[model samples]
Structures are given as C-alpha cells and as structure tokens.
Target: MKRLLFLLKKEFRQIIRNPFMLRAIIGVPLLQMLILVPAVTFEIKRLDLAVADNDRSPDSRELISKLTGSLFFRSAAAPLNMADAEAMLFSGDADMVLVIPDDFSEGLAGITTPRLQVLVDAVNATQAMLGWSYLTSIVRDYNREVIMARGAATSAIPGISTSPRYWYNPTLNYKYFMLPGILVILIIAIGLMLAGLNLVKELETGTLEQINVTPVRRWELIVSKVIPFFIFGLLDLALGLGVGWIAFNIPFEGSLLLFFGCSAIFLLAVLGLALFLSTLASNRQQYLFVAFFFTMVFILMSGIFTPTESMPGWAQQFNWVNPVAYLMRINRMVMLKGAGFHDIARDVGMLTVLAIAFITLAIRAYRKRA
Candidate 1:
C-alpha cells in the first residue's frame, strides 16, 4: 500500500510539473465540445429553389406561393424558359426547379390531374431526398385544400390525422441529440491519448527501465498508473457535464450517480485499451500510429454521426465489438432517454466484458524481462 501510494504521488507530481500538458488534457476536449456540438447538425435547412411557371393562372400562382412560404425553402431568380431553368440547375443556382404546365388550372377543374414537374439537383443525395419530401408534403396539402373547396365526395375510408409528440426533444433540436454523443467522443480521445502517450513517453525516456528495476510488483505498477488516469478522466467528465448543462441547456433526466458509476467502468475499459496499445508499441511514433488507427475505427463505427440501424449488416456486426459504441449507447440512453440500469443492462454487460478483456490482455503482454 505504501509503495503504491508513493508511486501515485510520483505520477501526479510529474503531471502537475508539466502545466501545458495539464491544460491540454482538460482544454482540448472542452473546446472540441463547444465547437462541434453546434457545427455538426443533421437538420437540413435553407434549400434554394427556382420556379419556371409557364401558366400565369391562379392555381399555378397559388402553388408557387405555397412553395415560397415555407421556412425550409427560398426562391432564387425566376427562370424564363425550360432552357433557362436547366441553365440555372447547371450553374448550381438552385437545388430544385418547379415547372407548372400551361393547362394546370384547366386540368384541376376537369377530371384530368394537373401535371407538375420538379427538377431536382440530386448531387447531394440526402438533401435531394429531404427536399423532395418537403415539396411533396406541400403539394399534398394543396390538393386536399382544393378537394375540400370543390366539395368533392369523400372516400369511404376516413383519412387519418397524426398528432406526433416528440419525447425528450420536443422541438427536434439537433444539439440535444448530438451533445451526448460528442461528450462520449471527448472522453475517449482524452483517456486514450493521455494514457497511451504517458506510458510510451516513460518507455522513450528510459524512466520505465528505472521503475522496472525497483521493488514494485507488476500489478502494483499497472494499478498505480491506472488509478490517477481514471480519477482524471472522471473529473474531466464531470466538467464536461457542467459545460453541457450551462452552455447547451441539456437536461439531467437520469441519475447522476448512475451516470458517474457507469463512466468509471467505461473509463477502465478505455484506459485498458490505451495501455494495451502501449504494450505493443516499443516507440512513441509506433504507439501514436496504433492509437490513431484504433481511435479512428472506434469513432467512425460508434454511430455518433450515423445510425447503426441504417448501416449494412456486416458493419452492424462489427459495431458490436466496439467499446465506444457501447459507451455512446449508454450515455445517450441515460442522458436523453432517462433510461434506468435495467434498460441499459445489455450495454453495461458488454462494457464489463470489454474492460476485463482489455485489462487482462494488457497485463499479460506487459513483460518485466523487456
């Protein structure tokens, strides 16, 4: 116990002596959270629209009015002809072009349905799909209004009206969904970078050899190293939560104690992975390359930017092994969904398994002979 405590003191003193490193440990993650939470949003907005109205009729004008009235769309300079509209699309001045036929009003009045052309720039596939959905919704509403005005006979089956209530995020604020995931990323980056670099630095500087010659047991050395980083990680997480609460107005819907408890377990797993990498790489450069490779894989496969359900079957299978994925799931579920331990039991179990696997491997690979 005395030996371990002395080693802990030595580790902390080394950390405190390097003021720049200390500041970087806390500052980098907080800065990234502030920048990325607002910048990385999935909500599509302000799509440019162009119109080529061949019919100067009331129905055509009404349709154009509806399109322009939406907050999602804005009208660009009107196109004079089909060729002109095509040119507008070619020049990237418009995301979509609305062309109303000359006989639109007559077609609406008679049995024939009015044919409207929507020329979309399908360059950005996501924006194109969302833009088409928005336009189709406007057209559907206009059609319903026209049918009601004409007193047309209703269908035998009554139409369904939907009243959607978005739980947790009523306004569908993208930040509310994104902030928790970003926090997970921040934690992992800090833990892995600091843990891997610290061990590798000792190896590079010949300090690790001196320690290896001492009376310290192998388990004692590992425990002492893990303890300080684990505490620092917890502190960083707490600071991040405070930032989220004050800056983003994020709610603390679940148990704070539970969140912290889970975070400690998750940190052990993350630090273990970093330490495991440190064991494999003999030099600082090799450790960095290995760290980056694993970190990149973890972040991309973690489903913070995209939904795992939307991924291909093989990708989803691989995501099961990703520790970051489990933590991301746990954090979001606890913070956003207000999920209890029972709800996140599966994720917790996976993390526990990962923690054991990584820490065991790291310990086994650490050679006193080396």
Candidate 2:
C-alpha cells in the first residue's frame, strides 16, 4: 500500500511538472464546453427560401407569408419565373424554391386540388430533408386552417387536435440533449489520452527500466498509473457540468452522487482501455496512433451527435461491446432523465464488466522486464 502511494505521488508529480499536460488537463474541457458544444448541433435554422409566385391570388400570397414568417425560413428575393427560382437553387443562393400554382385559390375553394411544386437543393441531404419537412408541416397547417374555416362557415365541428408535451425536456433545447454526451466525451478523452501515453512516455525517457527494477509489484504500478488519470477524468466531468450549468443554463435533474458514481466506473473502463493500448505499443507515436484509431471508433459509434436507434442494425448491435456507448446512455439517463440506479443498472453493470476486463488485460500485457 505504501509503495502504491509512493508511485502515485511520483506519477502526479510527473504530470504536474509538465506544463503542456497541465494546460491540456485544464483547457481542453473548457474549450470543448464553450466552443464544440454549440458548434456540434443538429438543429438547422434560418433556411433561405425563394418563391416563384405564378398565382397573384390572395391565398397564394397568404401561403407565402406563412412560409417566411416562421423561424425556420427567411425569404430571399422573389424570382420572376420558375426557371429563375431553379437558377437560385442552382446558384446555391437558396435552399428551397416554392412554386405556387395558378389554381391554388381554386383548390382552396374546393374547386380543385392544389399541386404545389417544391424544388430543394440536395447538396446537403440533412438540410434538404429538414427544410422540406418544415415546409410540408407549414402547408399541412394551412390546409387545416382552410378546413377549419370551411367548418365554421358550415357550422360544423372542428377536427381532432393534439397537444404534445415533451417530458424531461420541455423546450426541446439541443444543448440539454448535447451537454451530457459532450461531458462523457470530455472524460473519455482525458482518461484515454493521458493513460494511453503514460507508459510510452516513461519508456521513451528510460524511467520504465528504473521502475521495473524497483520493489514495486506490477498490480501496484498499474493501480498507481490508473489512480491519477481516474481523478483527472472526474475533475473534467465536474468542470463540464459546471460549464453546462453556468453558460448554457442546463439543468441537473439527477443526483450528483449518482452521476459521479457512474462516471467513476466509466472512467475506470476508459483508463483500463488506454493502459491496455499503451502496453501494446513500444513508442509514443505508435501509442498515439492506436489510441486515436480507437478513440474515433468510440466517438462515432457512441451515438453522441446521432441516435443509435436510427443507425443500421449492425451498428446498434456493436454498441453492446462499446464502452463509450454504454456510458453515453448512462450519462443521458442520469443527467437529463433523473434516472436512479434501477434505471441504469444494466448499463452500469456492463461498464463494470468492461472495466474489470480491460484492467485485467492491461496488467497481464505489461512486462516487468526492460
């Protein structure tokens, strides 16, 4: 125990003495929280809309007014013809072009069904899909209003209505959804990068040879290396949470103790994985490359920016083995949904298993011989 404590002190001292690492420990979380949180968002707003008003009718003008009035769209310069509107789309000046037909008012009068033409630039598929969805919803609302007006004129009853109440997140703020996932990312990055490079750095400096000759047990050395980085991961988690609350007005709906406890287990898994990678590589550059490859795989597959449910079946199946995916789910549940241990029990169990597996591998892979 005393030997472990001494090694822990030595590791801490090494980290503290390095200025670049100290800055990275402090600055990475702050920068990612302030900059990346806002930049990495799925919400598309203020799409440019070009309208070709073939029908000078009041109803057509009203439809145009509805399109431009919403927060989703801004009206671009009116085009004289459909060709000009298509040209706007071709020139990348507009995201969507709305062509109001001549019989639009007649369709509203029940004389004919309106067939409006919508042209969208497909360069950005996500933007095009979302923009088209927004336009479709607005047109549907206008059609509903027309029906309601007719119903009132005929003294008939109104149609069925729906009032959606989003539980957990009432405002549907993207930050509320993103902050938890981003926090997980920060912890994973710090733990993985630091722990992954530790042994390689020591090997390069000939310190590993010195440590190998010491009276320190292998498990004690591994424990000492894991302890400091685990602490750093928790520190980063706290920093991210504070930033989320102060800067973004994000709420912590769950117990801080529960969140921290879960984070501790997750950090153990990440640190173990990092150390395992470290044991496989002889040099700093080799360790970095291996760590980066795994890191990219973990982040992309972890459902940080996109929903795992929406992904293909094979990808969702892979999440079962992904430590980041399990932790990401746990973080969201604990932070956003106020989940208890009962709620996240299975995920926490998986993380615990992973932590044990990784740490065991790392210990076995580490050679005491220089």
The best candidate in terms of lDDT: 2
Per-residue lDDT for 1-370 in model 1, tens only?
8999999999899888989768977897678778988999978787789988888899889988898899888999999999999999999999999888888998889757789999999988888999999999999999888887788865753689899999988889899889888888777877788888888888888989998888778767777778888888888888888888888899778888878888888888988889889988899899889889888989888888888889899988997778888988888899988999999999999888988888887777787754
**Shift of residue 107 alpha carbon in model 2, Å:** 4.8
Q: Pick by TM-score: which candidate is best? A: 2
lDDT of 2 by residue, 172-193 (tens): 8898888888898898889888
Candidate 1 TM-score over all chains jointly: 0.90
| lDDT against the true structure, each candidate | 0.86, 0.89
The per-prediction tally of clashing pairs is: 0, 0
Residue 60's lDDT in candidate 1: 86
Candidate 1: where is the Cα deviation over 4 Å? 56-58, 83-91, 109-112, 149-158
